[model samples]
Target: MEATFEAFVRARGPALLRYAHLLCGDAGRAEDLVQDALVKVYRRWGPDIAAPSAYTRRAITNEYLSWRRRLTNREVPTQLPEPATRSHTDAIAERDAVWRVLAGLPRRQRVVIVLRYYEALPDREIADLLGLAEGSVRSLAARAFATLRAHPELRDAASVDRASRAEPSP
Candidate 1:
């Protein structure tokens, strides 16, 4: 059992860390979340479990979703410095802008978006994982999309990008 658990951790640990980072948008917190979930799973590790990867993934998701964890892990953002002027066509800047918007979303909405889009999971599977009804999952996703589409930062960034592309090269 010990060797099996060790092997599983070695194989799946990095993926779990990535998933946790996507779920929470924080690297340190992601590591902590994965570690906590693994500790819980290790206590019950045995040969009878049918799908260790799925089970471990579920555990990590549940840990991220826990309200108690949220209460304890609340982060107060420090004041950010003024943005340096940069070209709108910069891919890294665009990605950073998108990530900032995503990180601002409500926890459940962000989770739904990440699972649905990033993880390429269907709504039904996400609903099951979140212990929410399918309709609720759809609703959450729609709300998240609406928020993303309507976000001022994203709108400004996108408009600038489009305008930059529209201008003919001198």
Candidate 2:
């Protein structure tokens, strides 16, 4: 079981970390969070977990929700997960703008955006993973997308494409 767990971590760790990092916006905290969540998954590992990815995502979202519950204020950004890599000032500014729009959202809205857009999870799966009703997921996603779309730059595909290109290689 230990070997099985280790193999699974090796295979899925990168993607898991990516998700956690964006949600928390802090690399160190993201590592800490994923490690903590995985410990729980390991404790409960059994035949019922027919889908490892789904199980792990539930753990991730649950952990993030718990972390958000105790926040003092939303002003202090949980530092970004990615290290500095952009070459130009414009790139860094664009990245910061994107994070500001995302991080400023309420936790539930943020989760909806991250899961639906970033992970490309369908509404049904997102609902199950986040323990939310399907209609609630749809509502939250719609509101969040509306907020994002309200930003003229976000609505422009060319700008988004250019911003994506500016992201430095990790």
Query: Local error of candidate 2 at 121, Å?
Result: 1.1
- Could you tell me the TM-score of candidate 2? 0.79
Best by lDDT: 2
State model 2's lDDT. 0.76
- Candidate 2's displacement at residue 139, Å, is 1.3
The superposed Cα distance between candidate 1 and the true structure at residue 139, in angstroms, equals: 1.3
User: Clashing residue pairs in candidate 2, if any?
Assistant: 25-79
TM-score of each: 0.77, 0.79
Per-residue C-alpha lDDT of model 2 across residues 131-162, encoded as one tens digit per residue: 78989987886676566657654544455454
Encode model 1's per-residue lDDT on 14-38: one tens digit a residue: 9889888877766777899999999
Model 2 segments beyond 4 Å from truth?
A: 73-92, 151-170
Model 1: residues >4 Å from true position, as ranges? 67-69, 76-89, 156-170
